[model samples]
Every structure is written in structure tokens, then in C-alpha cells.
Target: MQRKRASHYIPTSTMELERLYRLLVLAILVNVVRGRFLPGPWIYAAHATFYGAEDAVATMGGACGYGNLYQSGYGTETTALSSVLFNNGLGCGGCYQIRCVNSKYCYPGSPYITVTATNLCPANWARPTNNGGWCNPPREHFDMSKPAFMKIAFWRAGIVPVAYRRVPCVKQGGIHFNLQGNYWWLLVYITNVGGPGDISKVSVKGSRTGWIPMTRNWGAAFQVFHSFQGQSISFMITAASTRETVIAWNVAPPSWKQGAIYMGGQLG
Candidate 1:
């Protein structure tokens, strides 16, 4: 007598299927509420103006202490944020997606451009807020590079209404640290960061020393007045928005020198 074979399919109870569907829907709703899935609904209104040459030559060595924009990997796709958004250099490295909303000045296809916040667009008290003081308090504005502005609107527009939203940065490689200052005072400029891009805090560790918190010197640079000479250096960087930490082990060798750039592990 042949034994009965077990069924190939296990039937799922209707209650269980309903529960799973509800869970899936809840997960999607959570992501949407957190601004992770759809950022389009979170877009904000702003105005944008352009400055510098078409090649963005004049935008180099900006307020962010990025030195050479090209060398820092920011290139022409960069922007100077208004004081409200700049937050005293803390906004450096943050990325934004901008699109011209003015039909009169918007490009034919209403193209959108992504830019890194690399500088501060200072407020001009000399001009009226509605006139030339576009970066005045409480107003969100972007002073984009000429090349970046042209990507979304006509050059002759001067300024255009725009819609923008914060977005994660997409970088090509690992994070970069440009060493500056002397052995007694170390200034490290962090760049090419991924994810939220902006750093909230930084801690440094050496082969012979424990972790030491570094202060924000200026822009994307951090500083520590302790000597770490002759010891390999590691970094613990905290993201501004998420507060997530990334440890880059042995980012610089013991023989690291000033003006040298070292590549470290990346953040998501």
C-alpha cells in the first residue's frame, strides 16, 4: 500500500494573510511619514539666484573652507545657502534638489539639479528684503553657481522661484580628510561624505591615544589641539541629521602630512 504524499502547498489562513498585508501597509506608511520614501510631498518653496562665472571659478575657496571646489569634488554643482539654512557652517556638505517653478524662467523641460551646500549666502542689510536682500532672515534662498542655475532656468532670469528639498548625497568614493595645521593643532576638513553628508560631531583616535572629541573649526573642518604625531589616526564621524556614527579606521598613517588628503571608509 502506497503512503499518502504530503501536500506541496501549505494554505495560509485568511486572518494571517490580512495581518501580513496590514503590516506591509504600516511599514510603507511609516517610511512616508519619515520622509524616506516620498520627498516630493515635502518640497519647500524658495527663490534662487546665480553668481560667479559660468565655470564657477569665482566660487572656489568658499566660506566652507573647501579650498578648491574641484579638488574637494564639489565642482560647479554647488550652492550657497541662506543664513537660515547655513546654520553657521553646520550645513556644509548637505545636498539639495532644486527645480525652477516659474514658467517664465524655467527651462523647457523644467529640469531639476542637485547641489551640495558648500558656502553661506550672507544677508545684505543694505537692500530691502523684497528687493536685493534675498538672503535675509527667515527667507530660504539658494545662491547657486551660474552653471548650476542654468541647468534649471534661463540665465537672463536673474532669480527664479524654485521648489527644493533636502536629499541624500551620492558621492563616488569614500570620505576624504584633508589635513591642515601643525602637529600641535590639527585641522581636518572632511569631504565627499555620503547620506546626509553634514557632520554633527567628530572624534579622533590615534594608535597611542584614546578617542578625543574634535571641535568644529569652520565649515566642514574640525580641529583638535592635541598632538597625534607619529601615530596612525582614526575618525568617528557622526551624521548631523541621523546622528549615526561611522568609524573610519586608520584613515591616515603615522607619516601623514599637512595638505595631504586621505580617503577613509564611507557612510550610507
Candidate 2:
């Protein structure tokens, strides 16, 4: 009889204790609500507590905030998506990550990466006519022209005889160039014209058509500043020459490291 009694008895384990506790709580809940407890309200509350508030905050934040991170050409939703895309370096064609900046507008072919901005105030923002003006539109692009300045500077101080003749062209060296605020300054030593004729007529024509003339030119120097994509600059020298006029050019390479200037004019 003792063995039978022991066999009939079941042990209460830790898990069983938990189960009993839950059941007891359920009974208390059922009595409190009088069998009126509904799962629909609980689920609704849970969802609203998280998702609903999240959506509300996002909308409010967007309205108040100046901008947000997003994919180029897409809004905030796209920005979030691009974070994943760029991290994978997807569709970049094996290019390693160099640098990235957050801006609304992006230049095409710029080595650095960019993030799109979502919102902007019209009065404060300056929009580009073509594409990729910082915070303008068509957001996210690479701009080769945006790099720091590299320059080529030559001086008339030193001289080296070429073919046993003292040449007007003297010491030539290059320096890095930077686009100054609204103007680029260039100094060149030239003969074949008097009164230190201005070369200010020089202009840079981008890959896209259209030319912007130099603002100031004096002392055989030229000053020009225009939006250009590291293209060829045509320097038209308006000297008081009889017939043959001196015209030269300089090609700004795609790589900002190399700056070149061509000085071609026969001094009489």
C-alpha cells in the first residue's frame, strides 16, 4: 500500500509551480473582468504604444527639422535604405570607400560619397540649374570640381639659356590652385605686349556648354571664378597686335593634383 501511494503521488517541480502561479493569476483576472477580457484591445494598445507613436514622431520631426539623411533622389525613406546600400558598396563597381559627406546636392563623378537631404527652406537654399546643388535637388552625386585647389605658378626671375639664347620664359614651377570666394586669381609673366595687358578675358568652359568671362584682369594677371568641371580654359589675349594675336590655354585635369598652363607667344 505504501509503494502504491508513493507511485500515485506526483512531484511539483519549479516549472509546475510557475504554471500554477500563472493559472492563479488568470483566474483572478477572469473574475475581475467577469469574463469580459478581450485580446483585441490589448493588441491594439501594444501596437499604438510603439508603431503609432513612432509614426507621429517621425512626421513631427520632419516638419520641424531642417533636413534628414536619405538616399540620393529619394526622401527620408530612401535615405534609410541607402545607408545599407552604401555600406555594402553596392553598384559602386568595386570602388573602395574613400570619404562621405552629408549634403542635399551631389556632383557627378566626385570620388567622395554624399547623403541626400530631405527638407530645405527655399529662400536660404541656392538651387543649381543643372543638378546637385547642395541641398537643392536630385540629391547625392560626385563632383570632381569640388576638390581643393592645386596650382601652377611660374616666375620671370630666374633664367636658363636654351640653345645659347636668353629666353623670355624663365623659371617655371607649379603650385596648387584653389578657387577663391567668387574669384580665381592667376599671375603670369608675359612679353609680346606692352602696358602689362590684362589677360582677364580668360574663361573656363565646362564639359557643359556656356562660358563665364573673367571678372578682373590686370598686370599680365587674370582672375576668373566660375562653376566648371575641371575642363579646358581658353585664354583669349586681347593685345594691341597688328595681325597675329597671342592666344593660350590651360587644361585643369580631372585629378586636382595636376595643374597645367601653356605659355606660347613669340616675343619680338
Error of 2 at 131 (Å): 63
Structure candidate 1, residue pairs in collision? none
Over the stretch 1-268, how does candidate 1's per-residue lDDT look in tens digits?
Answer: 9555587534369887788889999987775444231233435568999899897998898888898899888999999999999998889999999999956989887789999999999999999878999999888999999999999999899999998988888889899999989969999999999878888899999999999999998899999999988999999998877666788999999998898999988767
Error of 1 at 77 (Å): 0.7
lDDT of 2 at 185: 40
Candidate 2 C-alpha lDDT tens digits along 153-199: 01121111111101111112321122323324433322222211112
CA lDDT scores, all candidates in order: 0.88, 0.26
lDDT minimum window of 10 residues, candidate 2:
42-51
- lDDT for model 1 comes to 0.88
